[model samples]
Target chain A: MTTPTSRPDPRPAVTMSVGRDKHSHYSYRDFFRFNREQGTIIDWNNTQNLLLSEDFIVGLQTGLEREVGDASAAVMYTIGIDWGKRDAAHFSQWYEREYGVGVKQSNLLFLLETWWWPFTAQGWGKWEVETESKQKGFLFINLFDSMVARTLGDVGKPVCHLYAGLFAGFFTTMTSKELSCIEIQCYAMGETYCKFLLGGQERIDAANFWISEGASAREIARRLHQE
Target chain B: MNSMFAELLQNAEGRYLHPDELESLRAYVEGIPKRVRIYQVLHSKESVLLDRVMEKFQPTLPHLTRRHGILAWERCRRDLGMVWRYCCMAMLLNDEDYLRDKLLYWLETILKSFKMRDECRPAYKLMLDSLASIFTAEESEIIRPYLLLAKTMLVG
Candidate 1:
């Protein structure tokens, strides 16, 4: 860490019409700090200080696999679920403060988009939820340009366990129900885009089994509905 | 120049920063204008500078556009605007400590990759020149030292 310094003050202060806190909104600009002398970035806020280094992310995902062997996906899922729960609790506070405690009264799609805006800012790329099937105990999330999968490339398997865990965790808190999520299609698996299915653990487990049994995303959905 | 500001530049002995100057730095940062005259000048110069920047990065345009889509230039513009805001804030604050912290923060967290770091220097240099062009002779004299300090923070 570099130390702070004092410098020569320039011209006398002039008054401007800008709001004092007008620039205080959470922006990607506030995401990090710069150290001029050391030529490095320092994390800013405590809660929002996570860095977006693709190398670090790739290393972490593969590092977990090296350390835990076959169970790394499960471990990643568990971490993501916990992250989602904590994020939800923090998010709800902000949401309530900004929009009031009216999650139900808010437009559902708009609310979900609001929830996702920060992630987009953080370079997680754009995402959309399949609204019609959300009430049927299952929701589909289409992720365009997943940073994780894009970084890792076409690895030939469903590799977005972090996203799966995040969706599962987010929905579990929002709906007040135990939800599990799994990625049925992944960019790593040579898919054009990444897709996830969020629902009860039983439904997710069935999908996971089908995934292992060589079922396509559409086939998994069709087979699940027919059950 | 204030005594506090003088002490900050002196303390930039190599890469090590002294921790004691934080309080003065905070006060200085708090005093910066939310919007500055430089921002308006830079805002008007943005389009031309962006085009120049895009042309400079034309080699990587295909890959960047493929990954980030056709709005790559737009995204770069938005980020440049954001960074310029921070730079203006640092200029107003006029403390090496404040500028250093603010600059490092942006580079590390926001521009977390090498590709952005590579493009940032030339883009900022162009912006500085553009801002300087709009200054009167006397105004240029007054703003030069502070602006130069900001430039140093960016390039370093």
Candidate 2:
């Protein structure tokens, strides 16, 4: 989990030749304002039990318990921030401080890039990372329909729903012990969450769930039940 | 005349007849002059052309002689390329198990026939690409292992 001083290139090296949609540009600030107006932020924060409600947490805990069996404790953390040039770097720093124990440099960097920018900006992508430890444990996960608004150039209430469901799924499954810290980098309108995990059996298990064939949010829950 | 015809038909019934038998049959039928009667006789029976070819070039497993089976298989493949291509297309469209099996059988035959020929490379590539495109995510999972085998054979 020792954070590297130099940041790796966040973008894919190969250039894709797909054409972009010609329409209006949706800023992060606009997205955030719309979410606030629709009470998405409140629901996300659980201010009045509207967002990130107790029930969601219970369901998540239930799933985790099924997967890991009896756990000593479980906790959930929310991270958010505004748009800035140094946001990614700052997030990386916080992640290292939170989850740096026994995490490999390559895996940490790959996780940061995959979660922070690609998943946040592009809507969907997959990441696979292996620890540098003697056992070389690995983690894999994919985000789907997360960047629909950005990629498809359309935004409204539907985008918020997709984002909330995906992030909520992530938040519910991950534990404080499994993750060192949660970082939220804010933009003009919206924010991205980056979760860092301290290498543990649970984290590896979660990673396996992510890459397993035919895995989805529902499938992961079924797997947790079977376990 | 009926007995003569019966003798001729009985003579050609089974076994690999000489190539001259085919030519003589055609000539004898043409001499009948009555087109409808000739059509009735020929249409009533299956053409033994395929059987004759099969008899001439016996296809054996493990391909006893390298040149014999391989060369015969090549001729059959070239003759049946159109049929194989159609089978490949059908498999892509319907995703039928039987069609896919047939396509693979033909591909293997072609590959074995032209072991190191240039045609093998493109044919294998086309088959792989078609499989990748045609199969759904779930079906692809089942088909991927075979695809990998074909890929290794093409490469090695």
Model 1 per-residue lDDT tens digits across residues B51-145: 66556655554576676569876777776665555554555545444544444433333342223555556666665565545554543454455
With candidate 1 superimposed using the best TM-score fit, by how many Å does residue B104's alpha carbon deviate from the native? 29
Q: Over the full model, what C-alpha lDDT does candidate 1 score relative to the true structure? A: 0.65
Q: Mark the regions of model 1 whose C-alpha exceeds 4 Å error after superposition.
A: A1-27, A30-46, A225-227, B1-156
Q: Tens digits of per-residue lDDT for model 2 on A55-121? A: 5534554565587564302222122111111234444444455446322353433344423332332
Error of 1 at B30 (Å): 35
* The candidate that achieves the highest TM-score relative to the unseen native structure: 1
Q: What does candidate 2's lDDT look like per residue over B29-51, in tens digits?
A: 66444434433432332123223
Candidate 2 wrongly placed segments (more than 4 Å)? A1-145, A152-227, B1-156
Interface RMSD for candidate 2 relative to the native interface: 22.1
Give DockQ for candidates 1 onward, in order.
Answer: 0.03, 0.00
